[model samples]
Target: MMKIMLVDDDRTMQAILKTLLEMDKHQVVLWDGTSESDIFAQIVQEMPDLILLDYYLRDRNGIEIVKQLRQEPQTSHIRVIMTSGQYLRDECLEAGADAFLLKPYMPDELLRLLHQVQQNG
Candidate 1:
């Protein structure tokens, strides 16, 4: 099972994703999207196998975050899957996400992508 860190601001979405991921036998680590908590630090501490990053966060931009992650040597190789309600797949990929999922995507799609990323990694 992969350790997946979920970075999203919506509580309902968080709950739904946590349930879905847990059911798939993957460990889920929820980030509250608080600006006070250093994102990089949490990522390093968790050492998650993958990161599910939401595009439009409350305080920070997920695209920028992904760009930074790719730039950092310690975090560059970590797989990231970006999600957004808008059609920002190209931007997300350019920012270094392993994959992009549009919002309201089916649970099966997410799980499929998760496994696909693992396989490709």
Candidate 2:
């Protein structure tokens, strides 16, 4: 099972993602905050297989988060999937997200992406 980290400000979304990922037999770690320093630290320490980040955060933007993650050598190789309810697909891709998922995504899509990452990684 892949270890996944989810970062979103919405509790409902976090809960839903946790349920879906766990049902798929993947381990999940969730955070509702947007402190880049803290989150980056955790990512380096845990070294999860994938990271699902929300486009909109309470403290910082997803683009900035992606940029920071990419800039760090330790976390740069981590697969990042950015999710948003409002942003365009190209924007997330341009900001360095490996994949983009719109809000209200199907569980199958998430699982498929996870599988693709696992295979490619």
State which candidate has the highest lDDT: 1
The CA lDDT of each predicted structure is: 0.91, 0.84
The 10-residue segment of model 1 with minimum total lDDT is 32-41
Look at candidate 1 and give me any clashing residue pairs.
none
Tens digits of lDDT, candidate 1, 1-121: 9999998888899999999999999999998566624887888888888999999887788988888889998889889999999999999998899999998899999999999999999
- TM-scores, one per candidate: 0.95, 0.89
Show pairs that collide, candidate 2: none
Q: Write the per-residue lDDT of candidate 2 for residues 1-121, one digit (tens) a residue.
A: 8899998878888899999999999899987365655877777778888999888887677888888888988888888898888756798898788888887788898889878867877
Worst 10 residues of 2 by lDDT: 31-40
Candidate 1 deviant stretches above 4 angstroms: none
Cα lDDT of model 1 overall? 0.91
Model 2 RMSD in Å is 1.7
